[model samples]
Each structure stands twice: as structure tokens, then as C-alpha cells.
Target: MNKYFNIAIVTALSVAITSFKGNAMSDLSQYVDPFIGVDGGGNVFPGPCVPFGMVKVGPDCGGKDWNAGWDRDGNIHGFSNVHVSGTGGGCKYGNVLFAPITGNLDMQDYSSPRNNEHVALGLYEVDLKRYGTSARLTALQRSAMHEYTFPASDDSKIIIDLGSFLSSHERQYLVGSEVRIISDKEIEGYTRVRGGWNIGEPYTVYFYAVFDTPSDDCGTWKSHRVEPGKREQYDTSEPTGAYFSYRTSDKQKVTVKVGISYLSTGKARMNLSEMNSWNFDEVRAACVSRWNEILNKIEVKGSDEQKKIFYTALYHSYLQPVDKTGENSKWISDEPYYDDYYCIWDTFRATHPLFTLLTPSKQVDMLRSLLDIYRYEGYAPDARSGDDNGRVQGGSNVDILFTDAYVKGLKGIDYELALEAMIKNAEVSPGDDERKEGRGGISDYNEKGFVSTKFERAGTRTMEYANCDYAIATLARGLKEKEIAQKYMERSRNWQNLWNPDVESLGFKGFVWPRYSDGSWWSENDYSVFQGGTWPDFVYETFSWELSFYVPHDVNALIEKCGGKEQFTRRLDTYFSHEKWDQRWYMGLFQISNEPGFLTPTLYNYVGRPDKTAEVVRKTLKERYNTTKEGIPGNDDSGSMSSWYVFHALGFYPNTGQDLYLISSPTFEEAVIHLENGRDLSIKAKKASDKNIYVQSVKLNGEPLDACSFKHTDIANGGTLEFVMGSKPSKWGTVGVENQL
Candidate 1:
């Protein structure tokens, strides 16, 4: 093992051991079901991966649902070493594929119908019925170990397909590939591919593979021709791979270890040192142990079903924004490097904040990574993968993520550089590739104070830009950049510039209307409240009614603009009523499935209707989420949906880019958050049950909490947050309503 990897492993093991010693080590990984969202639009990858590890070794179905590559029903095409979990849209990764075969090597008919499939925290197993082979997969940080039990066959073979990747429904195209057989038992190669969700630049994935048993015959193949004597293969667009044929007895097990890196095949070979021995069980055990360490950070008292849902959500939340600390081949950075932000627009709402609270150290590393990317890449990403940034959604949501870490006082980040990045995002236009990074329509947004109708998703852009400005303003004020703070704070209210009071929706007087550069509103004929199309729509992925509720930093103003508390409260109620739900667009006014509506259920807290917030939150939790293959209501969005569940289940929700957490009902009787600062924040709900979902009273640190909100400072050092729950709504937080914002 390399010294650096050894040190990292030792440090990680020491931390896990210490945490195990500090707390009672329950087998928490048992509650995590990796398959919960594999079939649903959740698009979750059901595979073996350590928390935030680079290698997600899983099965690919080769279907259009290739986002995570595997669906519950499709045939197992192959097992690939990298995948994104719980993300939607175009797919990326799924590189370095390996498939076991028998008899004639017909690539076209090589896929097998899987049977006896199983998945857990760090293990995935399936029986490939066609080949009568049982494949078991496990992983460490950067490598994967596959154990395949093959039936008696002289032509038992393993194909390492360099050209194979998760494609379909996206624009993934292979740029080039090179494979060299090192020996009968080893091979080294790399694949250069471009275009996925991000429309990313061609990124090379280098890999090294080794087998425990040597093959009798090994050669290379391109497209349809298999060259028996050729030891190497290089190709641009044609399918290219290497095959090793072996004689095997019935139930003979063959183990293959593969390591991947973005830097080089040498680094990929070094990553194999993560698993020093060929003990697949040891790696699986270590992976389980690491998962236990993460899942144990927050212990909860609930039913097995609830625990399954909660812990699985927690598991999914840690699966992405992968920890590629020393693997950045793009630029030299000692600051921790991470990628597959997969887009911060989805995660900034809850996932990043959850990190700020539970895993502050990792959160700090991620923040540093963001700043470092800004340092080298000119812009911090809204969505990024393959060491490049692109496919920005809304404004630069990284501004919100950074401000969130700032307000919560996460350390080890250069706040000055962070502010500079935020300023650049606000002031600079991305020009041609604005869809990929930074803000689109920045000229009109800055000059006219609103994203004009000329821009697609203009209304949504205007609102998100306002939120990003608010985030910038918040961080600037804290850093004593008073003039910059004042400028952005005033600019933060520019969402109001898009508010056309004459435009009514669902009997509500005001909605954010798309405005032209000349400051004229788009005619009612030109737009619809349910402008539900994506990319080219007036709003992105949601209706104007939904985006209208998205003014998070200034909800008081939003409530006032919607005709005060009473009318606003009724509007929110009507949103959740489901009367206007349209299957054609998934157009429920309050879309629990999507991120835009994530905070709407809790908006009643702003109106001093904590009871209403509790009711809506609990209802959404009960109805929209469960522990099943199709459990998640929508795409998990790189754990964004799961983190939403994690927060609401624990009885609080974060207002991203702010220090505040809005109070709600708890599903568990007790939830203990083990903070990185060596303190435990315990949330206890008296009579917390399905029936008793309303908060009757609350106390923080034994003192009465009059409002339905609390700052991060209140729990940063850890304390008990006690809630008295009852079936009936009480005026517990109604009196101190002004404290919400």
C-alpha cells in the first residue's frame, strides 16, 4: 500500500473505532436497503459502495433508465465500477465494465436474466441465469472486487469492456479507448468519454484489473472481431474490450480486483492497494463498518419500517458528491477535491445543510473543494461531473451552498475567496455556455433587474438569482464587506420585479410573471401558470404557482405580497389540496417529488401556523415516502430527496443559505444527532406517533422555545430539543411568529 492511502485508511479506521467506542455500535447498516429507489423514478443505484467512495460497483440493465444503470426488472447486461446514486436526467459514469460469460463469445446475446438478486450497504449479489454464474461485488474507497462462481465450462470467460458505459436517454459518446493486457492475470487501460447530464468535456477514466487465477487464453476484441493473439486494443468509436477464457469446474469461484482513477492507470493500480489482500469478505466487512460509523452518527427510536426508511435515506444522502480527495487530475490542489456535485441546485436545499450539521469535517472539505474549483475553473459549478463544470440549473446555486456553510460557521474554508466567487457569479455572465456554468441571462438580470422573457426558464431564474443574491448578501455582511453586502441585499429583492400583481393564479392575486427586457410583462396569452415544460419553459420543472412560493430568504415579504398571513396560509393549504393535480405534467401545485416545492409544506411556519406545517409535513412523509422498490416519489436527486426526509423525520428543516431550521413534527420518539464537536443534540418528542403529529409545545435546552424556528448556534454545541406532541393543534408557536425569518 502507498503511504498516503495507508495513512488515510488508518485515520479513517481510527475515527470509526473511536466513534464505535464512544457510542454503542448497533448494526445500523442492517436498516439500509440499497434497492429502495432502484425501480422508481428515484433512479438510485443499488450496489456496493462505501459512503462517498468513488467506486460504485453495480449492475447495468442497458435500458433507458440508465441514470444509475440498473432497474428492478431488466436483464443484467454487465457490472460497471462507477455510478451516480439517486440522480435523474442524463447519465454519467458506469465506466470500466466487467461481465462473466460461458460458451461462445457472442457479445450481442451475452446479457443474462438475473435471479436471486440481493443488495445491501456494501454488497450486491445476483445469479446470471444464462451463464449460471453467481456474481458478488464489494468495494473499498477506489477499487472493486468481484467474485464470480461459474458453472463447469471450458470457455468460462470474463470480458473487460472499455467502451461500455451508461448510455441512452443522454448524449454519452466514447471519444477513445486503449487496453493493454499486462499478463494472464492483469490488464491496464483507460476510456475517454464525453457528454452526459453535464455535456461534459471528454474525461478519461484509467483502470487496472487483476485476477486471482490466471486465464488459459487472453486477447483483445474490437467491434465484432476477436483477435486471439493481439495483446492490446486501441479504438475511437468502435466497441473494444479484452477477454480471458478459463477452464472452470462447477461452482468454481474466480475473483477479480479492479481499481480506477481519473489521474492515470498507475494511480489506478496504486488504488488497488486499498484492498491489500484478495479477501473480498474483509473489504465487505470494512465497507459495512464504515457505513455503520456514518449511520450511527444519528441514532433514532422508531419502528423497523421507519428506521429502514430513515437509515436508507441517510445512506443514500452520503452516496454522492464523491470524495475524490487526492484524485483530481485536472488541477493540483492540496485542498480536498470532490466531484459529482451532480448539481448543487438539488442538494443545496437539504443535503449540504445536513452535512453541515452531522459531518462538519466532510462538509468543510466539500466547501474547500468548491472554492478550489472556483480558483482554477473560473466558476464554481451548479452541476459538475468528469472534472468539468456544466449544465447549470437556475442561478449558481453554489452561492447558496457556500453561504449555508458560512452562516452555520463551518471552518477550514476561505470565506474571502468564497465571497469573491459568489460576486463573480452575480456580476459576470457566462455568455455562450451559460447553460453549463454560472448565471444565464446575466446581462438582462443585472441591467434590467429581472431575467427577461428572452431567456428560457426566466421566471425561475429571476427567483433563484434573488436567492443567490440573498446568499451573497448574507455572507458579505458576516465578512464585514458592508458596501458589497448592501448592494447584493438590495439586489436580492429583484424577485419582486418579476411579480405581476395583475397575473392571478388559482384565485391568488400575484404570481411571478415572465418579464421582457423592456420591463413589460409577457401577455397572459404568452404564458401559462402551469408552464410545466423543462429547459425552454418560463419556469423550470415546476409551475409559476410553485415558484411563487420559492422566495425563501424573504418569506415574510412573500406572505405579504400574497395578501398577508391568513390569505397566504389559505393559499398554501390549497396548494396541498391536490385538487389541481395533473398527471400530464405531474402538476400538483405542491410537488413533494421535486426540489422547488420541498420547502412549501413548511411555509405555514412563517404564518404562525406551526400546526399546519406539522400536518402537511407528516402527511407528505406518510403518503409520498415508504420502504419499497418504488418508494421515493421522484428522482432522489443525489440524495436531495432523501435528505429532505432525514430533516423532516427529525422534526426540523433547514432554510438553506441561512442558519435557521424551521420546526416541524418528529416521526421518531427520540433522535440523537452526534455532532463532530463531541456533543449530541437530542430531539425528544413526547407522545410522538402517527396520531400525535402536531406539536403542542417545544423546549430547547430546558427553556421554552416560543417560535417555530431556531438558529444553528442554538444546537451547534449540542443540547436537548424537547417537543410535546398531541393529536390536536395547539397555539404553541403562534404568538412569536415574527421570529421565523
Candidate 2:
């Protein structure tokens, strides 16, 4: 960034920070702004969506029929259903149709700014300044508590529209309504929405409504087709538009109890039966209890701000990876019935990995969910996946996850069942993952073989042979998968074929010498490798460099290719120094921001430069992670990025699928990890601060030790790693696996 940009960001952030000094305590909800980046970056909606649920139940951003929460002038807009307030990609979600607007169920009423544009977690209340009315609603997972305060005119009516969900309109409308009045205070109705992707079959949903105390009401049900062109005809809004409503009486202060059902209208009525009275205390208590149970997983006794960020972040991490609250396994995949909200590529790395730690049991259940998806459709669930058939987007990260889990020793629920899922993921033939959309051609060497990028023809070959390569090698060498392992291990070394000498590493290069791979030349025509470049044209989302030479299985071979330990160490030094490296591209060690580069910080030990590993770990933690908005250095692929922080901060990394990590460095004076299993792991480093960056010596349980990393087994067995600090690096540790290439 330039000096001017830096100065402005600091000035803006400084003012914001100075004003947030009131309460600095941890309670999960306080630290969350939910609006910080929701304005423009990616209309990622920030709402009360629970961990693992499919629906993104939050404040509607990207506006609905011109209604948005954040105005360019920083004013708040109306709170609509199906909100993706703010996220990276600029996209919108379901609106109107099913969104029943109470008082003035007309989109034009919310065309301009009004006073009632505000939101709250667990509860959201906003006023329609123009209409002189207000609406407030809270939820308890399945049920909602609503209170709308409006003008005393008897013409006011609460619209009950079963077809509204964000932006579904006009020609796309397909709703089957069966409305019935149960009592003056209650009504049960069903709205079946028929649409797919953009327009498909009608999916059914039921609504159960209950009024506060009682009300004089006889109801008639009607279906309305949306006019997609209603894109803010209020003379102010444009393509930014979406809204829906059902008109009903507008009594002064009316209370409502609304319940939605996916089964039938009768089911929605049953929901009303289960929740009759307007029990504010009961609803609030119920919501709190659910949050407490999920939040209690990894408790932090830190400052208020830390707790908020931690828990809320933990909240973000847990959201959308699995089906925490669903029917059947309480989680369902699209392949079974074809649905929305499945970004497997984005969630696989960190999200699923993090889920393993928070809900271990859920892992098997998730696997079963995948298996069930397979049973239903012959393939594991891809994004809108068809189990074993059809091409999907990106690599099979689930494959690597399977191995990583087994190696980490996280097992139980159903080992056999889990293995079945793993086998299917590996064996599922590759067709088109990482299509690169309209782009084409080959990527750099590092881009090939990566599970996600089967974009180009060769890219597919690289992925096709990668897992069998790892599983085979790991089976024979690491996991002891002798017979079947060797076949796969040999294939795993395919990464070596793409290796070249010019840039000194593996790159995606076509044979014929004139072409290249990893460090070689890449065809600009190959858009498949555009995002994550193969060897020569390495292009990675976090950066091409990180992924360019990421071959975790062959560090020793890399040493030989680079010349020797000294040359290899010199390269390591370049990554940390962050300067003075010859380059055409320099995106911070390239893929340092993604999972491919996660293991990079620990490779120093393999080249006899343990001190470098320590330095990177320290710098990375302080630079990338903090108590601020920009704290997340990269897309938090679930928890892998954060999990990377957790593991590295403690001073080591899981090096290979061995699940064992080499101790490189420490970031704290003292830290303790209370394991889910009875035992606790403690880590302490002395003289470990800004200037004191080297490990003078390390001791395990007071006994002097060698090397910078430790094995997971050793820690799991219950032990501590103590370190002595110094201004210079120490090289007396184990001769170790100096060059496993």
C-alpha cells in the first residue's frame, strides 16, 4: 500500500477505535459490528445464522427493491429477509415473494431514507419513517417473536406472503398457497415455492402465525407474481432493488408468533400449537441457551474485546460448513433435492478443519451426510454436487482432510464409514474442477496436482494423480499402506515430473523443453491456472508464489533442486526478510495466505535453519492476526488459517500427514491448551519478544532437547516444551530429516 493509503486507513481506524472504549468485556455479541465491511466489499450479509445451518438468515443487504441497510451516506436501510449484508463477492440473495411486509406492504414506501432503519441481533426493529410505522422481530431457531408498532388506522394490515424470499419475482413465481384460519389470534398457511437455481421446481414451505394475546381477524389468502422490473420505481433506486409484502390490518401495537415449516402447512400449524402464547422470556432464554451450548466449546478468559472477536469469529467459523440444525442428520446436501448455499471450495480448507476441533462427532455425521448424498445420487456432494457423477468446481479437499484427520488421531463415530467417504472422494474421477470459467490453458507447476484446480487438461491429470500419490506414499512410508500404498506413492511423486531448474522448482510446464511447469513458463491462454498459476504461470488467490512450490511431501528433493542446504536456507531467508528476492511477482511468499503456504513457515527446520522458522511464526502472528478488522490475513478457510495460528503460536506445525509437527518457535511467554481428552498441553518460551527472536535452546520437561518441533503423539501423551531465549540462532538440535526430498 502507498503512504497516503496507509495514512488514511490509520486515521479512519484511529477515530473508530478511540470511540469504542465503553465496555471491554467478552460476551460473544458486543464486539460484533456486523456492518463493518457489509457496505461494499462483498455484500456478505451479517445476520443471526447459526453454525452449520444452510439458510443465511440475516439482515438483507445488496438491498431489496431498493431497500438496503447501509447507504452510501452511511445511513441504515430496511431490514429484509434473506440478507447477505456484506461479504467478499458482490452478490445478492432471496427477497420479497415470501417476505410479508406488515403495515404498508409496498416496496415504494421504503424507497427513500426513513428513521426506522436499524437492526439488532436475536432481535431487529426498524421504523418506516414515511409510513409512520415500525417493526421488530426476534428468533429462536425455528420460531420468531414479532411486534409491529404502527399508526392506529384500521386499514393497516400485516401481509402474510408465503412466496417471498429475497428477490424472487414475476415470471419466476411458483407458489402453492393453502391458507386456513385457526383462531382470531392464529392462522396457518403453506407456501410452496417452485424454482430451481434461477428457476426450477416448486419447493414447499409452511408458515404458522400467532398474534399477541388476541386480535379481531378473518383472513383470505392470495398469491402475487413479482415484477422483477419493480427495481425501485421510486425514482431513486436502480438495479439495486427487491421487496415483497402481504397487506393486513395495521393495529397500533400488535404482537405475532410466526413459525415456518418445510414439511407442510399442517406442520407449520403444529409449530404454532407448540408455541401459543407470546413468551418473550421463553424465546429469549431459548435462544441464549442454544448459543451458550455452542459457544462453550472453546472458552477464552481474555479481555472483553478478545472474547467477542474470538467467540463471534468462532461463530463465523462454525457457520455453513455442516448442518448443525437440520432434519435427518439435521444437515442435508443439494444433490439430494437440489438447493442453494453450498460453497464446498471455499469452506473445505479452514471451515471443515475447524469443525473437526469444535464438533468432532459431527465429522462422522457430515461424512455420513456425504455418503447419504452418494447413496441418493451415486456421488459425494459437490457444490450442487451429484455425488459420483458430473464435474464440480475445485479440488477434492475432503480427500486431504480425510488423511489429515486420521493422522491427527481424531477418530471415533464411525471409522469405517469415514473411510468409505474418503475412498469415494479419492476415486471419483476428475472431469472439470476449477473450470476457470471462460479461461483456459495450463498453470505453473505448483498449480497442477492441487485438488481444486482441475481446470485445464493437464491440470486435471495433475489432480487425477495427486491423492493416489499421497495416499500411496503415505500408506507405504507414513501410514504403512504397503500393497495399495506403493502404487499410489509412486503416482504421488508425479509432482517431481513437473519440477524444473530455471526458477529452481516444480511448475506446470508442458514437455518439449521449450515449455515449462512450476518455475517454468505458463501459457497466458490458460485461464484455468489464472487464479492459481501452475509452475511457470503460478496464480493463487492468496498469491501464486505460495502455491508455486508447495510440495509438502518432498522437502529433501527441493533442497537438491535448489542446490543444497545453504541455497535452500537462502531462499527461506528471502521469504521472511520480505525483500531482496529476485522476482517477476512478489505476493508475500506467494500462497502464504492460503493452506498451500500454511506449511511453508515450518520448512526451515528441514533445511537446518530452525531460527528462520521461529522468525516467520512470530512475524506472521503479530502482522496478520490482531484484535482489529483486518486481523484475518486470508480467507479463513473454516479454521485452517486460525487453526494454523493456534498450532503455530504454540510453537510447531503438523509437518506431514504424520500428524507430527516439528517445533519451530513460540509466540507467547506462556500458554496452555486444555485438550478435549483429559490431558493438557503446556508451552513456555523465555526471552521471546520482538528483539529476542532466536531459540537459544529448548527443553522438554526440563530436560535439554534437540530441534525446534515436537510430535503430536508426544504432546498427546502429556508433556511440556520449555525454551531458552537468545539474540542468535542455535543449530545444536537433532540432525533430523535435514533433506527429506
Candidate 3:
């Protein structure tokens, strides 16, 4: 009998297993806890949304820290129709709010304490303590359905706040807004706002809402004053909203459907066709079914806690870089258009690679969307939201994203056009608008072979740009452009320009140090191992020790620079074992909370120490992650962090912009990844447990594997990777270490 079946039997004896709607007990959505990352800095939206849906309808609490518009302990402000999931930094998209109340309208005091909250895939319900009402939220692709059950009152009303939005630490100003009541049952409005993560860039959101029944009275409000029976209100810089008052009996239920669009109110109204009826449960069931379709791509047999974390991570991974296929207002194209990348600097490591395995078609569409953005917008954005791009953290990491897809043979993208865009990022600087797109300080990088101290984040940008150049070189070689390929291949070594063999830290020599434009290094007195501060610093969100291990394309060179295999392995050990030194979020020198350190734990494979890699990865997976409100160690970074967990839990981690997966210990007994080519890539670990965590042996399709790595082609067409586990580390993948190098 299968180990999973045996475990299931044992679990069933101890607990009751409820079947989902008389279907198979294995409904994947049941394992997804939407509230897992709501606390900590995870900033995950715990509400109702389908896979990559534009309408992330959820309750918005007032605070600078609610980047995704929902906080665990915060009171309910209102349910907004637009939100980003698992993102940090500046807040965006809490627009077109609908708040239900049973008494006099108080714009400032309408927020209610919420309790009995329940969040699942495609459903969110919470009882508002102030109004004694229950709000249930569900969503379609571009619209939302809200059902509010209220207490008996003659003044029951639903307030449509056109000016309300999730404010961030950055300055957020409402440019203008308008609300027009078409009937007692209907209203249409729009809000134009600027300044969030997009950094002063303006975007407009138009909404059309309809109630299930006509109201007894209707009006509009500007700031604090309410004009009863008013049909229209237009204002700038002040709060504006519309209200529909109704006389309600005890436990009267009211339903509202809201559709939103970036183009115009007409399009918003047309988008409402996605949910034609007022059957909230029916729409919610459909959303749940859609979620199941995606989550079913990967099936795992593990403990219920393991299954919950895995499925929830999978669910969060598909939630963004949203599918705005027909919603683009900038340019019309038959190709798909996606926005809210929130930034590729974060997602390129793991999230996009996971998409390539599970949904290649959608991945292709997103790649094509990046190309489309480059076609009209001059360059593809590194960080995009609200139909605009503002921040560029690190290199034009989109180069890596495009190359990762190209190397994996994901079709439908114009690779030649993509190369052109990549070259633009390599060769040209975006000048004053460099923060929005393309490489900043490219003139210096192309001329000096390294970004220098004159530029902010010089050391980190140089390393990331080198990696981006490697991506360009790889793509160019695939396209048969020998000259371009060779040129970029040489430029990809620019990271070495910053390598100073004299700089020492934590008993390890030769760190990548900051340098000046004139080929001089920052003095030792001014530099520390953890020198860099956030944003406008020599490195972004990380220090020199962590950024030193970010060279994924040329690990051998990195190993050689660290004084060969033994020294590199010792350095990694020190990195993992060092005492906590500062207030930064890290374990030793490994900052599991950030993206820069994601690949560090797996770097041990290069030194033929797969055992150490397994040790660190399994330890991190156990200690740093959980299925709680504060589950994630850091901001999920639009599912980048969650995808990192998902990949590692399945016994592999992708080297982005390359076709490699480094082997790690499997958390589950078995995991089956359903490929896009109508095949299943199954991974099984025998005698795998908390104690039996080291791989004693591994076989690919019944053949013994010597190396701790596998190429994408190995499982592209589907195969079985079986691992024999043991309590003690063995030299299973230690032979033929040179092959890995």
C-alpha cells in the first residue's frame, strides 16, 4: 500500500475527514488557508479572488502597513474591489469600496470591529461588530459580489465610497473623483489617484455597481455633508460617496455586484456580465472550482499541515501579475496584457519558474505581455502596478524572466523582439526615469564594466546586471546571434570587476566591495559586512555577504573566487552558522526573509555538499515557515517567497534564467507535478521523514544519479525521480563533483 494511503488511514482514525460537496476528499482548495500570511510582514490579502483575478475584493482596514488592504487585527473599514496579494513596500489598489451599515451615515466612524472571520479559497465572511451585520465577499475576474446580512432598521444602507483607497507610507493624493446615481438601485463612478508604489504616477479606476433591490432613498456625499435625493457629485481632493437607504426587516439580506475597469465606466459596466445573476453562492462555487483547476496541477501526499502550507503557497503563487487581457487602456492588442507585476526583481527567482512548470500557456501569455509593454512603453517594467511602472529594484530582471522562458522552450513569444528589449536595457539608460524601467546607470556599466559609487545600489546593481547580461548572452546564443552572444558573454563577467580579494569579513576574504568610478574601493573604515541600508544604498535590502552568493549563472566562477571548493564550503558553513549580529531579519548571514538570499542555501551543491544543502533547506523550511497568520518569514513579494517554499517542499529549486534544478530533501513522501504537455513529473522519497532527511541515493527513471542537480530536459517530457532517504548523510551525490562544476 502507498505510504500516503497508510498515513491517511491513520489520520482518519484520529479525526473526521469531511468530503467536499460529495466529491473526492482530495479537493485541493480545502487545504488552502488564505489567512496564513496575513500577519508578520507577509501582507497577504485574505479575501476572495480567482487565479490572477483583477477584482481582489476584500475588506480594507485603515493603516499604512496594510499594503494588501487587509490586516489580521485591524477593524473593517470597507470591502474594496481591487487589491494586490502578498506584496510589501507601498500600498496600492483598495478602490471602489462598499460598506453596509444599519444607522445614520458617519463617513469617519463607519468602520466596525470584525470577528468570526472566515477566509477560504474564493470566499471571505466576517461579522461587523458595530452594525451587527455579516459581510460575505466573492469575486469574478473583474467584478465582485458582496452579500450583507443586517439587523432590523429603517435606515439600512450601503455606502459606496468613491474616494476611499488604501494609503501607503508614501504620499497618496486623490486627483479627482465623480459619483452619479443612475437609479435608486444603481450607481457609476470613477476615481483618479496618484502616488503609491508607482511613485506619483496617476491611474484611473471606474466602477459600476448595482444593488439587488431599489432603495427607499438615495443621495450623494462630499466630505461630511450628505445631500439626500441628489443624483450626482463631483469633487477633487475631498471624500466623496453615494448612499442607498432602505427599510429592512430582521436579518434582511442585501446583495451588491460591482464591476471595475481602468478604461471607462462603460467598460466597467460591461465587465459586470461576468456575474450576471445575484447568486453569490453560485458565483463563489465557480470561483472555488477555478482555484481547484490551478491547485490541482501539483498534488502532494503529506501531513495535513504540510498539505495546507503547500497548497496555500501554490494558491498565492498564481494570484498576481494579474491577467488583464482586455483591460489595458494604453494600447489595444490581441496579445494578453498583465499588470501589477509589483516588480520582477522579486518574482524572477522562483514564481515565474513555477508558472512555467504548471501553466506554460499562461506563462507565455505573460511573456508576450512584457513584450507588448516594451513595444508601447519604451521598456518593460521591473516593478509595475496601477497600469504604470515607477521603481526599478536591481537590474532589468525581466531579461532573466524572458530568458528563463526561452530556454525552457515555452512558445508563442517573439524571441527576437525580446532580445531587442534586453539589449536596450543593457545598452541604454533610462536617464531620469531609470527608476521606472531599464537599467539605471547603464552608461557607467557599459563603459566602466561595473556600476560605481556614484550610483545608488552600485554593488548590487553591478551583480544583477552581470546576471542579466548572462541571460542576454544565453538568449542570443539560442537565437544564433553569435556576435551579440559573445559580446554579452564577456560583459556578464562585470560582476568580477567589483570583487576585491583584499576585503575580509567574518574570517572570509575576497568579498564583492563597493568601488568608485576611478577604480578605487571604499575604505575599510566606511565599509562593514552588513553595510548596505534599504533602497538608496550600496545594496537593496541586503548586505555584501548575502549579495555575494547571487551569481546563479556562473557558480563555478563564484566558487573559484571564494578560494576553491573546500574554502567555498567552509564559507557557506560560516554563513549558515554565524551568530545573529544585528537587527536585520536573518538567520546567521542567510537572510531567509529576502530574495537575495533565496539561492544561498542551495549553493552547497556546487561544492559537492548536497547534505549541507539539504540540512539548511530543511531547517529553514521547518523553522521559518508555518500555517498561521504570521506564517511567512517576510513579505511574500507577490508570491515569490511562497513559491520558494512550494518549490523546496517538493525537493527541488530552480536556478532562474537557467534550465537547472538543484536537488534537496523532499518534505512529502511523494509529489506529482502535472506538466503542460499532458504528462506527470513525479517525485517520490522512500523512508522520508523528519529524521530520514538526507538522501542516501537518487534515481532518475530507475537510473542512479551521481550529481545533485538535473536539467530541465530531464523531466520536461515527464519522468520519475525517486530518492532513498536515510537518517545519516551519505556520499550519494558526492561523486563526479566536477560535472556539477
Q: Poorest 10 consecutive residues of model 3 by lDDT?
A: 1-10
Off by over 4 Å in 1: 1-24, 235-237, 582-588, 736-741
What TM-score fits each model?
Answer: 0.96, 0.70, 0.95
Error of 2 at 32 (Å): 5.6
Residue range 1-741, candidate 2, lDDT tens digits: 011223433343233221111322123444433332233222323444434433333333234331222343432334333333222222233432222233434543323234544433343555555556666555554456666665655445554444344442322243445555566566665544443222333544556666764543334433333343132111111121222222344445666766655655555555445444464434433443345445554443445554444454555555444342233222354422322323344454445555554455565456555556555544454443101122233344444555555666665434444445545555544234333111123233234433222333343334324533474345344444466566556556665554434332232232211133333444445432224432333332433334434566666765666667777676666555554233222333433444556667777787667777777777776566555434555444333455566556556666544555677666566755544454556677787666677887888866777755555556654577787777777764535443322
Index of the highest-TM-score prediction: 1
- What are the Cα lDDT values of the candidates? 0.87, 0.46, 0.86
Give the alpha carbon lDDT tens digit for every residue of 394-505 in model 1. 8889999888888888888899999999999999888787788889998998999999989888988999999999999899999999999999999999999999899987
**Candidate with the greatest lDDT versus the true structure:** 1
Evaluate model 2: give its TM-score. 0.70
lDDT of 3 by residue, 1-741 (tens): 011223433343223223223334345777999999888999888999989999999999966769888876678899999999888777887988899988888866799998888887778888898998889898989999999888899999899997888887775678878899998788999988888876847788999998898899989998768899888887666768899988988888889999999999999999998897687767776677678778878888889899999899999898998998999978898889999998799999999999998888999999999999999988977888888876898999999999999888888899999999999988887988778888998888999999998998898899999999999999999999999999999998899999989988878899889888898999989887777566778899888988888788888899889999999999999998887665245677787888999988888888888999899999888888899998998899999989999999989899988888889889888888878787889999998998988999999987999999887878988999999999999988875233321
- Clashes (candidate 1): 1
Query: Comparing candidate 1 with candidate 3, which one achieves the higher TM-score?
Result: 1
